[model samples]
Target: MSVWLPTAPCTPRTCAGHTGPVRGRLPATALLLAGCSLVLAGVVCVPVVMLLGRAPRDRLIRWWAYGVVRAFGVRVRVTGRPQSPEGAAHTGTLVVANHVSWLDIPLVAAVLPGRMLAKSEIRRWPVVGPLAALGGTLFVERDRLRALPTTVRDIAGALRGGSRVVVFPEGSTWCGRGPGGRFRPAVFQAAIDTEAEVRPVRIAYRTARTDGQAAGAAAFVGDDPLAASLWRVVTAAGLTAEIGVLPPIPAGTLPGRRALARAAQTAVASDSANRSAESVHH
Candidate 1:
Protein backbone atom coordinates (compact mmCIF):
# COMPACT_ATOMS: atom_id res chain seq x y z
CA MET A 1 0.00 0.00 0.00
CA SER A 2 1.13 3.53 -0.66
CA VAL A 3 2.43 5.37 2.39
CA TRP A 4 0.02 8.18 1.68
CA LEU A 5 -2.88 5.74 2.03
CA PRO A 6 -2.16 4.48 5.50
CA THR A 7 -4.77 2.35 7.30
CA ALA A 8 -5.70 2.11 10.95
CA PRO A 9 -6.69 -0.95 12.97
CA CYS A 10 -9.84 0.76 14.24
CA THR A 11 -13.10 -0.60 12.88
CA PRO A 12 -16.54 0.74 13.60
CA ARG A 13 -17.68 -2.55 15.07
CA THR A 14 -14.70 -2.81 17.37
CA CYS A 15 -13.67 0.69 18.37
CA ALA A 16 -17.02 2.43 17.95
CA GLY A 17 -18.71 0.59 20.75
CA HIS A 18 -19.16 3.40 23.25
CA THR A 19 -22.57 4.88 22.57
CA GLY A 20 -22.76 6.93 25.78
CA PRO A 21 -26.18 7.98 27.07
CA VAL A 22 -27.99 7.89 23.76
CA ARG A 23 -30.76 10.39 23.21
CA GLY A 24 -34.38 9.60 22.45
CA ARG A 25 -35.25 8.92 18.82
CA LEU A 26 -37.19 12.17 18.40
CA PRO A 27 -34.37 14.38 19.67
CA ALA A 28 -31.77 12.54 17.65
CA THR A 29 -33.81 13.04 14.51
CA ALA A 30 -34.14 16.74 15.22
CA LEU A 31 -30.42 17.10 15.84
CA LEU A 32 -29.60 15.23 12.65
CA LEU A 33 -31.89 17.48 10.64
CA ALA A 34 -30.39 20.60 12.18
CA GLY A 35 -26.83 19.44 11.47
CA CYS A 36 -27.60 18.63 7.87
CA SER A 37 -29.36 21.95 7.45
CA LEU A 38 -26.31 23.82 8.70
CA VAL A 39 -24.13 21.94 6.25
CA LEU A 40 -26.44 22.78 3.37
CA ALA A 41 -26.55 26.39 4.41
CA GLY A 42 -22.76 26.47 4.33
CA VAL A 43 -22.79 24.96 0.84
CA VAL A 44 -25.19 27.58 -0.44
CA CYS A 45 -23.12 30.45 0.96
CA VAL A 46 -19.78 29.26 -0.39
CA PRO A 47 -19.78 31.56 -3.40
CA VAL A 48 -20.37 34.61 -1.24
CA VAL A 49 -17.84 33.45 1.33
CA MET A 50 -15.19 33.08 -1.36
CA LEU A 51 -15.63 36.70 -2.37
CA LEU A 52 -15.06 38.05 1.11
CA GLY A 53 -11.61 39.13 2.32
CA ARG A 54 -9.45 36.68 4.32
CA ALA A 55 -10.38 37.90 7.77
CA PRO A 56 -14.13 37.98 7.30
CA ARG A 57 -14.16 34.71 5.40
CA ASP A 58 -12.21 32.99 8.15
CA ARG A 59 -14.46 34.44 10.83
CA LEU A 60 -17.57 33.25 9.00
CA ILE A 61 -16.06 29.84 8.41
CA ARG A 62 -15.22 29.45 12.08
CA TRP A 63 -18.70 30.50 13.05
CA TRP A 64 -20.28 28.08 10.61
CA ALA A 65 -18.10 25.21 11.82
CA TYR A 66 -19.03 25.88 15.42
CA GLY A 67 -22.70 25.93 14.50
CA VAL A 68 -22.49 22.66 12.65
CA VAL A 69 -20.87 20.87 15.59
CA ARG A 70 -23.38 22.34 17.99
CA ALA A 71 -26.24 21.42 15.69
CA PHE A 72 -25.21 17.83 16.02
CA GLY A 73 -25.61 18.27 19.80
CA VAL A 74 -21.91 17.99 20.42
CA ARG A 75 -20.38 20.28 23.01
CA VAL A 76 -17.01 21.83 22.17
CA ARG A 77 -14.24 22.85 24.56
CA VAL A 78 -11.05 24.36 23.14
CA THR A 79 -7.91 24.94 25.22
CA GLY A 80 -4.62 26.73 24.56
CA ARG A 81 -4.27 29.85 22.48
CA PRO A 82 -3.77 29.41 18.77
CA GLN A 83 -0.28 30.49 17.73
CA SER A 84 -1.82 32.38 14.82
CA PRO A 85 -5.25 33.75 15.61
CA GLU A 86 -7.79 33.83 12.84
CA GLY A 87 -7.70 37.00 10.70
CA ALA A 88 -4.30 37.98 12.09
CA ALA A 89 -1.48 38.86 9.71
CA HIS A 90 1.04 36.07 10.04
CA THR A 91 3.37 33.75 8.23
CA GLY A 92 2.09 30.45 6.86
CA THR A 93 1.05 27.97 9.55
CA LEU A 94 0.91 24.23 8.93
CA VAL A 95 -1.65 23.04 11.48
CA VAL A 96 -1.15 19.34 12.17
CA ALA A 97 -3.39 17.15 14.31
CA ASN A 98 -4.05 13.51 15.09
CA HIS A 99 -7.02 12.01 13.21
CA VAL A 100 -9.94 10.79 15.33
CA SER A 101 -13.27 11.25 13.54
CA TRP A 102 -14.75 12.97 10.52
CA LEU A 103 -15.85 15.60 13.00
CA ASP A 104 -12.18 16.44 13.52
CA ILE A 105 -12.19 18.44 10.28
CA PRO A 106 -14.86 20.92 11.36
CA LEU A 107 -13.70 20.78 14.99
CA VAL A 108 -10.28 22.08 14.05
CA ALA A 109 -11.65 24.56 11.54
CA ALA A 110 -13.84 26.07 14.26
CA VAL A 111 -10.63 27.26 15.93
CA LEU A 112 -8.18 27.47 13.03
CA PRO A 113 -9.96 28.02 9.75
CA GLY A 114 -7.65 27.29 6.86
CA ARG A 115 -7.11 25.45 3.63
CA MET A 116 -7.45 21.78 4.58
CA LEU A 117 -5.32 18.86 3.46
CA ALA A 118 -7.79 16.12 2.54
CA LYS A 119 -7.90 12.93 0.51
CA SER A 120 -8.79 13.44 -3.13
CA GLU A 121 -11.84 11.20 -2.79
CA ILE A 122 -13.55 13.75 -0.58
CA ARG A 123 -13.94 15.94 -3.62
CA ARG A 124 -16.41 13.41 -4.98
CA TRP A 125 -18.56 13.22 -1.86
CA PRO A 126 -21.99 14.78 -2.23
CA VAL A 127 -22.72 18.14 -0.52
CA VAL A 128 -19.35 18.11 1.27
CA GLY A 129 -17.24 17.66 -1.84
CA PRO A 130 -18.40 20.84 -3.48
CA LEU A 131 -18.20 22.80 -0.23
CA ALA A 132 -14.65 21.60 0.41
CA ALA A 133 -13.48 22.57 -3.07
CA LEU A 134 -15.11 25.98 -2.79
CA GLY A 135 -13.47 26.49 0.62
CA GLY A 136 -10.00 26.02 -0.93
CA THR A 137 -9.14 22.57 0.37
CA LEU A 138 -5.86 21.04 -0.77
CA PHE A 139 -6.67 17.55 -2.05
CA VAL A 140 -4.09 14.75 -2.11
CA GLU A 141 -4.05 11.78 -4.47
CA ARG A 142 -3.28 9.26 -1.78
CA ASP A 143 -3.16 6.31 -4.15
CA ARG A 144 -0.38 7.61 -6.32
CA LEU A 145 3.14 7.83 -4.94
CA ARG A 146 4.36 9.63 -8.09
CA ALA A 147 2.00 12.52 -7.31
CA LEU A 148 3.59 13.02 -3.86
CA PRO A 149 6.08 15.63 -4.94
CA THR A 150 3.46 17.60 -6.80
CA THR A 151 1.19 17.60 -3.76
CA VAL A 152 4.07 18.77 -1.58
CA ARG A 153 4.81 21.56 -4.04
CA ASP A 154 1.20 22.72 -4.04
CA ILE A 155 1.14 22.73 -0.22
CA ALA A 156 4.39 24.69 -0.11
CA GLY A 157 2.97 27.21 -2.53
CA ALA A 158 -0.06 27.77 -0.29
CA LEU A 159 2.21 28.21 2.72
CA ARG A 160 4.43 30.58 0.77
CA GLY A 161 1.34 32.60 -0.01
CA GLY A 162 0.86 32.98 3.77
CA SER A 163 -2.14 30.70 4.08
CA ARG A 164 -2.75 28.50 7.10
CA VAL A 165 -3.05 24.84 6.00
CA VAL A 166 -4.65 22.21 8.24
CA VAL A 167 -3.44 18.64 7.80
CA PHE A 168 -4.02 15.40 9.74
CA PRO A 169 -0.55 13.91 9.54
CA GLU A 170 -1.75 10.54 10.86
CA GLY A 171 -3.03 9.89 7.29
CA SER A 172 -5.98 7.87 8.71
CA THR A 173 -8.58 8.05 11.43
CA TRP A 174 -7.81 6.31 14.69
CA CYS A 175 -10.25 5.49 17.53
CA GLY A 176 -8.79 8.13 19.89
CA ARG A 177 -8.32 5.21 22.26
CA GLY A 178 -4.52 4.88 22.16
CA PRO A 179 -1.60 6.03 20.06
CA GLY A 180 -2.66 6.65 16.49
CA GLY A 181 -0.67 6.09 13.33
CA ARG A 182 2.72 7.77 13.11
CA PHE A 183 2.87 11.20 11.57
CA ARG A 184 3.53 10.58 7.92
CA PRO A 185 6.60 12.63 6.98
CA ALA A 186 5.41 13.71 3.51
CA VAL A 187 3.24 16.67 4.60
CA PHE A 188 5.94 17.90 6.95
CA GLN A 189 8.09 18.47 3.88
CA ALA A 190 5.83 21.36 2.94
CA ALA A 191 6.50 23.05 6.29
CA ILE A 192 10.24 22.49 5.88
CA ASP A 193 10.19 23.92 2.37
CA THR A 194 8.26 27.02 3.33
CA GLU A 195 9.78 27.32 6.82
CA ALA A 196 6.23 27.55 8.14
CA GLU A 197 5.41 27.10 11.80
CA VAL A 198 3.96 23.67 12.60
CA ARG A 199 1.14 23.91 15.11
CA PRO A 200 0.33 20.50 16.57
CA VAL A 201 -3.27 20.24 17.81
CA ARG A 202 -4.72 17.28 19.67
CA ILE A 203 -8.40 16.34 19.11
CA ALA A 204 -10.24 14.15 21.57
CA TYR A 205 -13.88 13.05 21.83
CA ARG A 206 -15.32 12.43 25.29
CA THR A 207 -18.76 11.85 26.78
CA ALA A 208 -20.30 14.00 29.52
CA ARG A 209 -20.84 10.79 31.48
CA THR A 210 -19.46 10.65 34.96
CA ASP A 211 -16.72 8.26 33.83
CA GLY A 212 -15.51 10.79 31.25
CA GLN A 213 -14.40 8.10 28.85
CA ALA A 214 -13.60 8.59 25.18
CA ALA A 215 -16.75 8.88 23.06
CA GLY A 216 -16.63 5.97 20.63
CA ALA A 217 -19.76 7.01 18.76
CA ALA A 218 -17.69 9.74 17.10
CA ALA A 219 -15.20 7.33 15.56
CA PHE A 220 -15.40 7.01 11.78
CA VAL A 221 -13.04 4.18 11.11
CA GLY A 222 -12.75 1.27 8.65
CA ASP A 223 -15.72 0.55 6.41
CA ASP A 224 -18.13 2.68 8.40
CA PRO A 225 -20.89 4.14 6.33
CA LEU A 226 -21.14 7.90 6.42
CA ALA A 227 -24.83 7.80 7.24
CA ALA A 228 -24.24 5.44 10.14
CA SER A 229 -21.57 7.67 11.59
CA LEU A 230 -23.75 10.73 11.28
CA TRP A 231 -26.64 9.05 13.04
CA ARG A 232 -24.34 7.74 15.73
CA VAL A 233 -23.02 11.20 16.49
CA VAL A 234 -26.41 12.91 16.69
CA THR A 235 -27.91 10.20 18.85
CA ALA A 236 -25.01 10.11 21.27
CA ALA A 237 -25.82 12.29 24.26
CA GLY A 238 -23.38 14.61 25.97
CA LEU A 239 -20.59 14.05 23.47
CA THR A 240 -17.94 16.70 23.88
CA ALA A 241 -15.15 17.40 21.45
CA GLU A 242 -11.98 18.89 22.90
CA ILE A 243 -9.32 20.71 20.93
CA GLY A 244 -5.89 21.12 22.53
CA VAL A 245 -3.58 23.45 20.63
CA LEU A 246 0.01 22.75 21.59
CA PRO A 247 3.09 24.92 21.16
CA PRO A 248 4.18 25.62 17.62
CA ILE A 249 7.39 24.16 16.23
CA PRO A 250 9.42 26.34 13.88
CA ALA A 251 10.41 24.26 10.87
CA GLY A 252 13.77 26.01 10.67
CA THR A 253 14.67 24.54 14.06
CA LEU A 254 14.23 21.01 12.69
CA PRO A 255 17.01 19.64 10.51
CA GLY A 256 14.77 17.65 8.17
CA ARG A 257 11.18 16.71 7.42
CA ARG A 258 11.37 13.50 9.42
CA ALA A 259 12.63 15.32 12.49
CA LEU A 260 9.91 17.90 12.07
CA ALA A 261 7.27 15.21 11.82
CA ARG A 262 8.62 13.45 14.90
CA ALA A 263 8.65 16.65 16.91
CA ALA A 264 4.99 17.34 16.08
CA GLN A 265 3.94 13.76 16.80
CA THR A 266 5.69 13.94 20.18
CA ALA A 267 3.96 17.18 21.09
CA VAL A 268 0.51 15.80 20.31
CA ALA A 269 1.22 12.49 22.05
CA SER A 270 2.66 14.18 25.11
CA ASP A 271 -0.39 16.40 25.46
CA SER A 272 -2.68 13.41 25.21
CA ALA A 273 -0.81 11.65 27.99
CA ASN A 274 -0.93 14.71 30.20
CA ARG A 275 -4.64 15.12 29.62
CA SER A 276 -5.29 11.46 30.33
CA ALA A 277 -3.39 11.73 33.61
CA GLU A 278 -5.45 14.74 34.61
CA SER A 279 -8.63 12.92 33.77
CA VAL A 280 -7.57 10.02 35.96
CA HIS A 281 -6.66 12.35 38.82
CA HIS A 282 -9.95 14.18 38.65
Candidate 2:
Protein backbone atom coordinates (compact mmCIF):
# COMPACT_ATOMS: atom_id res chain seq x y z
CA MET A 1 0.00 0.00 0.00
CA SER A 2 1.27 3.49 -0.86
CA VAL A 3 0.80 6.21 1.70
CA TRP A 4 0.49 9.81 0.49
CA LEU A 5 0.62 12.91 2.60
CA PRO A 6 -2.36 15.26 2.27
CA THR A 7 -0.01 18.15 1.55
CA ALA A 8 2.12 16.25 -0.98
CA PRO A 9 2.63 17.71 -4.45
CA CYS A 10 0.40 16.21 -7.12
CA THR A 11 2.24 14.09 -9.69
CA PRO A 12 1.56 10.71 -11.26
CA ARG A 13 3.85 7.96 -10.03
CA THR A 14 4.15 4.18 -10.22
CA CYS A 15 4.97 2.58 -6.89
CA ALA A 16 3.41 0.12 -4.45
CA GLY A 17 0.04 -0.24 -6.25
CA HIS A 18 -0.36 3.54 -6.77
CA THR A 19 -0.94 4.34 -10.43
CA GLY A 20 -1.96 7.99 -10.36
CA PRO A 21 -0.83 11.29 -8.95
CA VAL A 22 -1.55 11.95 -5.31
CA ARG A 23 -4.15 14.64 -4.77
CA GLY A 24 -3.30 18.03 -3.30
CA ARG A 25 -4.52 18.86 0.18
CA LEU A 26 -7.90 20.33 0.98
CA PRO A 27 -7.75 23.86 2.39
CA ALA A 28 -7.23 23.90 6.15
CA THR A 29 -10.68 25.39 6.67
CA ALA A 30 -12.34 22.84 4.40
CA LEU A 31 -10.61 19.96 6.14
CA LEU A 32 -11.62 21.43 9.49
CA LEU A 33 -15.26 21.67 8.42
CA ALA A 34 -15.22 18.10 7.20
CA GLY A 35 -13.72 16.95 10.47
CA CYS A 36 -16.30 18.86 12.44
CA SER A 37 -19.14 17.31 10.44
CA LEU A 38 -17.88 13.81 11.14
CA VAL A 39 -17.59 14.61 14.85
CA LEU A 40 -21.10 15.99 14.96
CA ALA A 41 -22.50 12.99 13.11
CA GLY A 42 -20.94 10.67 15.63
CA VAL A 43 -22.01 12.72 18.63
CA VAL A 44 -25.59 13.51 17.58
CA CYS A 45 -26.59 10.64 15.31
CA VAL A 46 -25.12 7.76 17.30
CA PRO A 47 -27.25 8.48 20.33
CA VAL A 48 -30.38 8.97 18.25
CA VAL A 49 -29.99 5.55 16.63
CA MET A 50 -29.65 3.97 20.05
CA LEU A 51 -32.85 5.55 21.40
CA LEU A 52 -35.12 4.57 18.53
CA GLY A 53 -36.63 1.13 17.91
CA ARG A 54 -35.08 -1.26 15.34
CA ALA A 55 -37.14 -0.13 12.35
CA PRO A 56 -36.61 3.60 12.84
CA ARG A 57 -33.17 3.07 14.37
CA ASP A 58 -31.92 1.35 11.24
CA ARG A 59 -33.41 4.02 9.00
CA LEU A 60 -31.64 6.84 10.81
CA ILE A 61 -28.42 4.85 10.93
CA ARG A 62 -28.65 4.18 7.20
CA TRP A 63 -29.25 7.84 6.39
CA TRP A 64 -26.47 8.85 8.75
CA ALA A 65 -24.22 6.36 6.97
CA TYR A 66 -24.85 8.18 3.70
CA GLY A 67 -23.94 11.44 5.39
CA VAL A 68 -20.70 9.99 6.75
CA VAL A 69 -19.66 8.81 3.30
CA ARG A 70 -20.31 12.23 1.81
CA ALA A 71 -18.60 13.96 4.71
CA PHE A 72 -15.46 11.99 3.87
CA GLY A 73 -15.91 12.95 0.20
CA VAL A 74 -16.06 9.31 -0.85
CA ARG A 75 -18.15 8.67 -3.94
CA VAL A 76 -19.96 5.35 -4.29
CA ARG A 77 -21.53 3.88 -7.44
CA VAL A 78 -23.56 0.72 -6.87
CA THR A 79 -24.23 -1.74 -9.68
CA GLY A 80 -26.82 -4.56 -9.84
CA ARG A 81 -30.02 -4.63 -7.83
CA PRO A 82 -30.00 -5.99 -4.28
CA GLN A 83 -32.02 -9.21 -4.24
CA SER A 84 -34.94 -8.48 -1.99
CA PRO A 85 -38.37 -10.03 -1.52
CA GLU A 86 -41.33 -8.45 -3.21
CA GLY A 87 -43.34 -6.19 -0.88
CA ALA A 88 -42.22 -6.64 2.72
CA ALA A 89 -41.84 -9.93 4.58
CA HIS A 90 -38.97 -12.20 3.54
CA THR A 91 -38.40 -15.68 4.97
CA GLY A 92 -34.72 -14.74 5.22
CA THR A 93 -32.31 -12.76 3.05
CA LEU A 94 -28.61 -13.22 3.76
CA VAL A 95 -26.42 -10.48 2.27
CA VAL A 96 -22.86 -11.67 1.71
CA ALA A 97 -20.43 -9.01 0.48
CA ASN A 98 -16.66 -8.82 -0.04
CA HIS A 99 -14.77 -6.90 2.65
CA VAL A 100 -11.99 -4.46 1.84
CA SER A 101 -12.09 -1.71 4.47
CA TRP A 102 -13.92 -0.75 7.63
CA LEU A 103 -15.88 1.60 5.38
CA ASP A 104 -17.59 -1.46 3.90
CA ILE A 105 -19.99 -1.40 6.86
CA PRO A 106 -21.55 2.03 6.27
CA LEU A 107 -21.33 1.68 2.51
CA VAL A 108 -23.52 -1.40 2.61
CA ALA A 109 -25.54 -0.31 5.62
CA ALA A 110 -26.49 2.82 3.71
CA VAL A 111 -28.48 0.56 1.42
CA LEU A 112 -29.46 -2.47 3.52
CA PRO A 113 -30.28 -1.98 7.17
CA GLY A 114 -29.95 -5.70 7.94
CA ARG A 115 -28.24 -7.06 11.02
CA MET A 116 -24.53 -7.50 10.14
CA LEU A 117 -22.26 -10.22 11.45
CA ALA A 118 -18.74 -9.18 12.51
CA LYS A 119 -15.91 -10.84 14.43
CA SER A 120 -16.08 -10.98 18.21
CA GLU A 121 -12.95 -8.91 18.92
CA ILE A 122 -14.58 -5.80 17.48
CA ARG A 123 -16.79 -5.79 20.59
CA ARG A 124 -13.91 -4.20 22.49
CA TRP A 125 -13.24 -1.37 20.07
CA PRO A 126 -13.93 2.25 20.92
CA VAL A 127 -17.23 3.93 20.12
CA VAL A 128 -17.88 1.70 17.10
CA GLY A 129 -18.15 -1.41 19.27
CA PRO A 130 -21.13 -0.21 21.22
CA LEU A 131 -22.85 1.34 18.21
CA ALA A 132 -22.51 -1.90 16.28
CA ALA A 133 -23.86 -3.96 19.16
CA LEU A 134 -26.85 -1.65 19.65
CA GLY A 135 -27.49 -1.63 15.91
CA GLY A 136 -28.06 -5.42 16.04
CA THR A 137 -24.70 -6.63 14.75
CA LEU A 138 -23.96 -10.33 15.45
CA PHE A 139 -20.41 -11.02 16.61
CA VAL A 140 -18.80 -14.45 16.28
CA GLU A 141 -15.71 -15.77 17.99
CA ARG A 142 -13.89 -16.88 14.86
CA ASP A 143 -10.91 -18.44 16.62
CA ARG A 144 -12.78 -21.04 18.64
CA LEU A 145 -13.89 -24.02 16.62
CA ARG A 146 -16.50 -24.99 19.17
CA ALA A 147 -18.14 -21.60 18.88
CA LEU A 148 -19.00 -22.00 15.19
CA PRO A 149 -22.26 -23.94 15.66
CA THR A 150 -23.50 -21.57 18.33
CA THR A 151 -22.82 -18.59 16.10
CA VAL A 152 -24.51 -20.27 13.18
CA ARG A 153 -27.47 -21.01 15.42
CA ASP A 154 -27.58 -17.36 16.42
CA ILE A 155 -27.68 -16.29 12.76
CA ALA A 156 -30.30 -18.90 11.89
CA GLY A 157 -32.41 -17.77 14.82
CA ALA A 158 -32.15 -14.18 13.65
CA LEU A 159 -33.24 -15.21 10.17
CA ARG A 160 -36.11 -17.30 11.54
CA GLY A 161 -37.22 -14.15 13.30
CA GLY A 162 -37.59 -12.53 9.84
CA SER A 163 -34.53 -10.27 10.07
CA ARG A 164 -32.04 -9.92 7.22
CA VAL A 165 -28.38 -10.66 7.98
CA VAL A 166 -25.22 -9.41 6.24
CA VAL A 167 -21.94 -11.25 6.52
CA PHE A 168 -18.38 -11.11 5.18
CA PRO A 169 -17.65 -14.81 4.60
CA GLU A 170 -14.02 -13.97 3.85
CA GLY A 171 -13.57 -13.89 7.66
CA SER A 172 -10.71 -11.38 7.41
CA THR A 173 -9.97 -8.48 5.08
CA TRP A 174 -7.09 -8.15 2.65
CA CYS A 175 -5.24 -5.58 0.54
CA GLY A 176 -6.90 -5.87 -2.88
CA ARG A 177 -3.76 -6.81 -4.78
CA GLY A 178 -5.53 -9.60 -6.65
CA PRO A 179 -8.79 -11.53 -6.40
CA GLY A 180 -9.90 -11.25 -2.77
CA GLY A 181 -9.26 -13.97 -0.22
CA ARG A 182 -11.53 -17.03 -0.19
CA PHE A 183 -14.80 -17.34 1.72
CA ARG A 184 -15.17 -19.58 4.74
CA PRO A 185 -17.84 -22.26 4.36
CA ALA A 186 -19.03 -22.59 7.94
CA VAL A 187 -21.28 -19.57 7.87
CA PHE A 188 -23.30 -21.06 5.06
CA GLN A 189 -24.90 -23.49 7.50
CA ALA A 190 -27.14 -20.77 8.82
CA ALA A 191 -28.63 -20.24 5.38
CA ILE A 192 -29.18 -23.96 4.94
CA ASP A 193 -31.02 -24.35 8.21
CA THR A 194 -33.36 -21.48 7.47
CA GLU A 195 -33.39 -21.99 3.69
CA ALA A 196 -32.44 -18.35 3.21
CA GLU A 197 -31.37 -16.72 -0.02
CA VAL A 198 -27.65 -15.92 -0.11
CA ARG A 199 -27.01 -12.60 -1.83
CA PRO A 200 -23.45 -12.21 -3.08
CA VAL A 201 -22.15 -8.62 -3.12
CA ARG A 202 -18.88 -7.21 -4.48
CA ILE A 203 -17.53 -3.76 -3.53
CA ALA A 204 -14.69 -2.41 -5.68
CA TYR A 205 -12.92 0.84 -4.89
CA ARG A 206 -12.03 2.82 -8.00
CA THR A 207 -9.65 5.75 -7.76
CA ALA A 208 -9.14 8.20 -10.62
CA ARG A 209 -5.87 6.67 -11.72
CA THR A 210 -4.40 4.38 -14.35
CA ASP A 211 -2.41 2.22 -11.96
CA GLY A 212 -4.48 1.03 -9.00
CA GLN A 213 -7.80 1.61 -7.25
CA ALA A 214 -8.27 3.65 -4.07
CA ALA A 215 -8.94 0.48 -2.05
CA GLY A 216 -5.15 0.22 -1.67
CA ALA A 217 -5.21 3.22 0.60
CA ALA A 218 -8.33 2.41 2.61
CA ALA A 219 -7.82 -1.32 3.24
CA PHE A 220 -7.40 -2.20 6.91
CA VAL A 221 -4.75 -4.91 6.66
CA GLY A 222 -1.42 -6.04 8.11
CA ASP A 223 0.12 -4.34 11.16
CA ASP A 224 -1.35 -0.93 10.35
CA PRO A 225 -3.07 0.65 13.34
CA LEU A 226 -6.68 1.78 13.11
CA ALA A 227 -5.59 5.42 13.41
CA ALA A 228 -3.13 5.09 10.50
CA SER A 229 -5.79 3.43 8.34
CA LEU A 230 -8.16 6.31 9.13
CA TRP A 231 -5.41 8.79 8.18
CA ARG A 232 -4.90 7.13 4.79
CA VAL A 233 -8.64 7.26 4.11
CA VAL A 234 -8.89 11.01 4.84
CA THR A 235 -5.79 11.83 2.77
CA ALA A 236 -6.37 9.70 -0.32
CA ALA A 237 -7.76 11.46 -3.41
CA GLY A 238 -10.39 10.48 -5.97
CA LEU A 239 -11.66 7.49 -4.03
CA THR A 240 -14.90 5.88 -5.18
CA ALA A 241 -16.56 2.64 -4.11
CA GLU A 242 -18.46 0.45 -6.60
CA ILE A 243 -20.80 -1.99 -4.87
CA GLY A 244 -22.31 -4.85 -6.91
CA VAL A 245 -25.17 -6.70 -5.26
CA LEU A 246 -25.53 -9.80 -7.38
CA PRO A 247 -28.63 -11.92 -7.73
CA PRO A 248 -29.32 -14.11 -4.75
CA ILE A 249 -29.16 -17.94 -4.81
CA PRO A 250 -31.72 -19.77 -2.72
CA ALA A 251 -30.32 -22.28 -0.28
CA GLY A 252 -33.09 -24.75 -1.15
CA THR A 253 -31.71 -24.83 -4.67
CA LEU A 254 -28.31 -25.97 -3.46
CA PRO A 255 -27.53 -29.51 -2.32
CA GLY A 256 -25.97 -28.50 0.95
CA ARG A 257 -24.09 -25.86 2.90
CA ARG A 258 -20.69 -26.52 1.27
CA ALA A 259 -22.18 -26.18 -2.17
CA LEU A 260 -23.90 -22.95 -1.19
CA ALA A 261 -20.61 -21.53 0.05
CA ARG A 262 -18.80 -22.53 -3.14
CA ALA A 263 -21.52 -21.01 -5.30
CA ALA A 264 -21.49 -17.71 -3.44
CA GLN A 265 -17.68 -17.67 -3.37
CA THR A 266 -17.48 -18.21 -7.11
CA ALA A 267 -19.86 -15.35 -7.78
CA VAL A 268 -18.15 -12.89 -5.45
CA ALA A 269 -14.61 -13.88 -6.49
CA SER A 270 -15.36 -13.63 -10.20
CA ASP A 271 -16.82 -10.16 -9.80
CA SER A 272 -13.76 -9.07 -7.79
CA ALA A 273 -11.35 -10.44 -10.41
CA ASN A 274 -13.15 -8.61 -13.20
CA ARG A 275 -13.00 -5.37 -11.22
CA SER A 276 -9.26 -5.87 -10.64
CA ALA A 277 -8.67 -6.23 -14.36
CA GLU A 278 -10.80 -3.20 -15.19
CA SER A 279 -8.87 -1.08 -12.70
CA VAL A 280 -5.59 -1.88 -14.52
CA HIS A 281 -6.74 -0.72 -17.96
CA HIS A 282 -8.07 2.66 -16.81
Which candidate gets the maximum lDDT versus the true structure?
A: 1
Candidate 1 is scored at a TM of: 0.92
For residues 26-121, write the lDDT of model 2, one tens digit per residue. Answer: 642354367557756664566566777777877776677666665665676666665475774467778888777777887887777688898788
- If candidate 2 were superposed on the true structure by all CA atoms, what would the RMSD be? 7.2
Alpha-carbon TM-score of each model against the true structure: 0.92, 0.80
Model 1 residue pairs with clashes:
none
Please list the Cα RMSD from the true structure of every candidate, rounded to 1 decimal place.
3.5, 7.2
lDDT of 1 by residue, 43-104 (tens): 88998899999999999999999889999989888877775656643669999999989899
Displacement of residue 121 (Cα, Å) in model 1 is: 2.2
lDDT of each: 0.86, 0.69
